[model samples]
Target chain A: MAKELLKGNVAMAEAAVRAGCEAYFGYPITPQTELLEHMAARMPELGRAFVQAESEVAAINMVYGAACTGKRVMTTSSSPGVSLMMEGISYIAGTEVPMVLIDVMRGGPGLGNIAPAQGDYTQMVHGGGHGDYKTIVLAPASVQEAIDLTALAFDLADKYRAIVVVLADGSLGQMMEPAELPEMQPLKKQLPDWAITGEPGRDRRLLTSIYLQPEDEETTNIRLQRRWMEIEANEVRYQEYFLDDAEIVLVGFGTAGRVALSAIRHARAEGIKVGLFRPVSLSPFPAEALRLVARKAKAMLVVEMNAGQMLNDVRLVTQGACPVDFYGRMGGVVPLPDEILSEIMRLARFTPHDLNGHTRAAWLDRLEVVRGAK
Target chain B: MVATDIQNAKLVYERPESLADVATHYCPGCTHGTAHRLVAEVLDEMGIREHSIGVASVGCSVFSYNYFDMDFVQAAHGRAPAMATGVKRVFPDRTVFTYQGDGDLASIGMAEIMHAAARGENITVIFINNAIYGMTGGQMAPTTLPGMKTTSSPRGRDVETQGYPIRMSEILATLDGVSYVVRRSLHNPAEIRKSKKAIRYAFETQQRGLGFSMVELLSSCPTNWGMTPLDSLTFIEDKMVPAFPLGDYKVIDAVKSMKWKEG
Candidate 1:
C-alpha cells in the first residue's frame, strides 16, 4: 500500500487496530486523547470492543481483564494518567497477562504541561510498579516508526506474555507525517492454552497475581526474570548514523533522538566527526551496540526532552569508555536542532578524559540562564 | 462409597458440582462461605458452570477463585467491577461476575462500580456487605453502620463526625443503566434462601441481556465483630439489617415479570 499522510496518535490507533487489537479501554488525556478518540470511532465499526473508562486505573484494569480472555487489548494515556495507572499496571504485570499501553508523554514530575517530553524513561525502561518484572519499552521517533513499533508491540507482548509499551512523546503523538501502515491482520481464533475463556471441553483456568507464600512468590519472580533474559538476548534494536571513525557520538530516543539526528547531520556538514545513536527498544536497550560505539568514540553527548533520564543508561553502558555529557530541555520544552548541534560542537572541542558525572550543576546553570532570559 | 454404591444411596445433600472440592479459608461463622455456596448452587442450577468466569476482589473474597471450579482471575483491590466489564465485553456469551466485599465494592471501588452500572454492563455482581473490612482486620467500611464499632471505629462510628453509611443498592438503583439491584440478607435460612434467589435473578439479568444487576448480601464476620459465630449472625440481623434495610432497590419491568426460580 502507498504511504498516506497520518497524524501520529491516529496512525498508532490504526496500527493497533490492524495488528488485531480486539479491545481498547482508555480515558481521555491530552496528547494521547486522539488515539483513544480514533479507537472509539473505529473499534465499533469493525465489531470489536471499545470502552471509555472512568479513569486510568479503570482503563488499565479493563485492559488486564480483556487480555485474560486471550484477546488483543490496549490503552493510551499521557504522563499523569499513566501515573494513575501504575497501580493497575503493577497488577497487570503481576497477573502476567499480555497487553499493550501507549504513553504519549508530556512534561512531568507532576501535572506538567501537555507538550513534548521524555520524562517516563525510568518508569518504562526500569521498574515503575512493584515487583521484579520487565516491560518491553519501544521508543518511536516518527509517525512511521510509531506505526511499525505499535504493530510489533502486540507480537512481542504475545510472544512473551508481558506488557509492551509504545513510549512516544507529545510531539510525535500530535505531529502529522507521511507513513505506510501495515496490512490488517486477522484476529486470532484460538485462545492460548493459559487464557481464561471459561469455555467447555477444556479445564478451567485461574490467573492471579497473589501467591500468598514467600516460596511461591519467589518462583513467580524467577519465572519473570527468566523470561526477561530471553528478551534481552534477542530483542535489542537501535540505528547508528555516521559512526565510522567518529570521535563524538550523540545519544537520544523518540523526539529527542529524531532531533539529535538533525544535529548530527549539521555537525558533520561543519566537518565535525559526530554521529547519532538512536535506541528503539529501551528496556532490552542496545547496550552491546553502545559499548562498541563507546569503544571508538572519545566523547558522547546525551540529549533529551527531560533532564537527563536516559543519559544515565547510556553512561552505564558506556562505562567510562568515553565521557558522556548531556543537554536537555524540560517541562514541555522542545529543543531545536541547533541547541543540540552546539552541544555536539562543545563536546567535539573539549574531549574530557574523565567522567562528566556532575551534570546537575551544569544543568542548573543552563536552566538559570534560560529562566533569567525569560 | 464406590460410585455404584453411591448411586443407590439418596443424594439428598452434597456440595454443588460448581463448587470446588477443596476447603475454603474463610473463618468459621463467617457468611462468605455461605454466600459462595449459594452462588455455586445458582451456577449449577443455571448450568452455566462450564462457561462461567469469576473475578475475585481483594479482601476476604480475594481467594474466591480457589472456591469456584471455573475460569477465574483475581483483581486489584476495588477494581473488580472494571475487570468484570472488560471480561463481559470480550466474551458476551460467557457468564461473568465479580465477588467483592464492602470495602472493595462500596468504598475505594465506588467509582468503578458506579460507572459499570451506569454503563449498563451486561454482568452480574455478588457484593458481600459485612459492614467492615474483614480481610483487613475490621476497619470501618462504607457500609458500616453509623454506630457500629470496628478496628478503625473502636469508639463506634460517630454519624455526626464520620458521616452515615452508604446504601449502595439504593444509590445504584437510581441509575438508569441498572436492570436489577437489590439488598438481601444471609442472617437466617429464610433470608439465605431469599439471597440465593436474588443472586439467581442477578445472573438471569445478565443472561437475558438486561444490563447490570447486583445482589448486596448483608453478611457476617464473626472474628472481626469480636463475637461468637452465632452472635455475629444475630448482629447482622439485629444491627446491620435495621441500619441498612433490605428489599428490592431496583427492578426493571422485564426482571419483575420473570418467574422466580426455586431450584
Candidate 2:
C-alpha cells in the first residue's frame, strides 16, 4: 500500500479495523476521540459492532463482553477516561479475555488539559487496575509506529489471552504522518474453544473473573504469572541507536523516546558520545537491555512527558550499576528535541552527585522556577 | 413412585432443560431460585437455550451463569446491562439477557440499566427486586421501602434521611426506547405464573426486535429480611407491593397489539 498522510488516532482506528476488530466500544475523550469517531464511521460500514457507551466504565465493560466472544475487540480513551475504565479493565484482565486498548494520554491526576503527556506510563505498563495481571503495553513513538503497533496489539492480545494497550500521548495522537496502512485481515471463521459464542451443540462456555474459591483463584493467578513469565521471556522489544561505543545513554519510551532520539543525534555531533535506548514494550521494561546499557555507560538520563514515571522502572532495571538522571514535563507539556538535547548536553558535563535518586527532586525544583516551559 | 410404570406414565413436572441438574447455592426459601427457575423455564420453553447469552450481575444472582445452560459472562457490580449490550450488539441474532438483583440493578447499576433501557438495545433484563441486599447480608437496597428495616437501616429506612424507594419499572417505562416494562412478584403460584408469562412476553418483544424489555420480579430475601420464609413472602405482599406496585408500566403499542402465546 502507498503511504498516506494520516493522523495517529485515525491511522490507529483504521489499523484496528484492518486487524479484524469485530467490535469497538468507547466514549468521547480528547485525543482518543478521533479513534472512536473513525470506528463509528468505519465499523458499521464493515458490518461490525460500534457502541458509543455512556461512560468509559460502560465502554470497558462492553469491550469485556465483546472480548468474551473470542472476537477482536477494542476501546480507546485518554488518561482520565482510562482511569474511569480501571474497574472494568481489572475485570477484563482477571477474566483473561483478549482485547485491544489505545490510551492517547493527556494530563493529570484530575481532569487535566487535552495536551500530550506520558503520565500513564506507570498506570498502563504497571497495573493500574487491581490484582495480579499484566497487560502487554506497547509505546509507539510516531504515527507510523502507532499504526504498526495498533495492528500488533490485536495479535498479541489474542495470542496470550491478554489485554494489549497501545500507549500514545496527545501529540502522537494528533500529529499527521505518512504511513502505509496494512491490508485488511479477514475475520476469523473458527471461534476459539473457550469463546462464549452461544453455540448450543458445543459444550457451553463462560468468561468471568470470579474465582470465589481461594485455592482456585490462587491457581489461576499462578497460571497468569506463568503466562506473564513467558511474555517477559519472548516479547521484550527495544530500539538502540549508537549504543555500540557510547558512555552517556538516554532512556525513554513513546514520544519522549523519539525526542531523545533527536537529542542523541545532536549530542553525538557535539562529541557527547550519547546514545538512545527506547523501549517499545513498556511492560516487559527491556530490563536486561537497560542493565547492559548501564554496565557500559557512565550515566543515563531518562526523559518523559510526565514527572519521570518511567524513571522508576529504569532505576529498578539499572540497579545502581550506573548513576541515573531524570528530565520530565508534567501536565500536558510535550518535551521538545532541543530540551532533550540540552539534557543530554547537561549529562555530558555531569558531575558524580548530579545523577542520584535526588535527580527528580532537583529537576522539579528547577522546573518550578520556570513559569511554563518544556 | 414406581419406576416400572414410569415409562407408561406422563411426567407431570421436571426441571427445565435450561437449568443445570445440580442444586443452586441460593438460601433455602429465597425467591432468587424461584426467579431463576422462571427465567430458565422461559428460555427452555422458548427454545432459545442454544441461542441465548446470559449476563450474571454481581449479588446472589452472580452465580446465575453456573445455573443456566447457555453462554454466560459474569459482570462487575451493576455492569451487567452494559455487558449485555456489548454481547447483543456483537451477535444481533443471539438472545441476550441480564439477571440482576435489587442492589445490583437499583443502587450501583442504576445508570447502566437506565441507559440500556433508554437505548432500547433489544435485550431483556430479569431484575430481581427483594428490597434488601441478600448476598451482602441485609444491606438496604435502593428499592428498600421507606419504613423497611434491614441491617444497614436497622432503625427503619427513614424517608427523611434515606429517601423513598425507586420504582424501576415505572421509571424505565417512561423511556422511549423501552418496548415492554412490567412488575411481577413470586409471592404466590398465581403471581409466579404471571411473572413467567411476562418474562415470556419480554423475551418475545426482543425476539420481534421491539427494543428493550424487562420484568421486575418482587422477590423475597428471608435471611436478609430477618423473617421466616412465609413472613418474608407476606412482607413482599404487604409492604413491598405497595411501594413497588405490580403492573404493566409500559407496553408499547407494538407489543400490546402483537399476540404472544406462552410457549
Candidate by candidate, in order, the iRMS in Å equals 0.7, 0.8
CAPRI level of candidate 1: high
lDDT of 1 by residue, B1-263 (tens): 59889789886889998899999999999999999999999999998999899999999888999999999989999999999989988999999999999899988899999999999999999999998999889999998888889989899999888888999999999999999999999999999999998999999988889999999999999999899999988998889888889999999999988774556
**Per-model TM against the reference:** 0.98, 0.98
Query: Taking the candidates in order, what DockQ does each have?
Result: 0.86, 0.83
- Alpha-carbon lDDT, every model: 0.92, 0.90
TM-score of chain A of 2: 0.97
Best by lDDT: 1
Q: In candidate 2, which residue ranges exceed 4 Å CA deviation?
A: A351-356, A369-374, B1-7, B260-263
Span of ten consecutive residues with least summed lDDT in model 1 chain A: A355-364
lDDT of 1 by residue, A130-153 (tens): 888889999999999999999999
How big is the positional error of residue A216 in model 2, measured in Å on the Cα after superposition?
0.1
lDDT of 2 at A143: 92
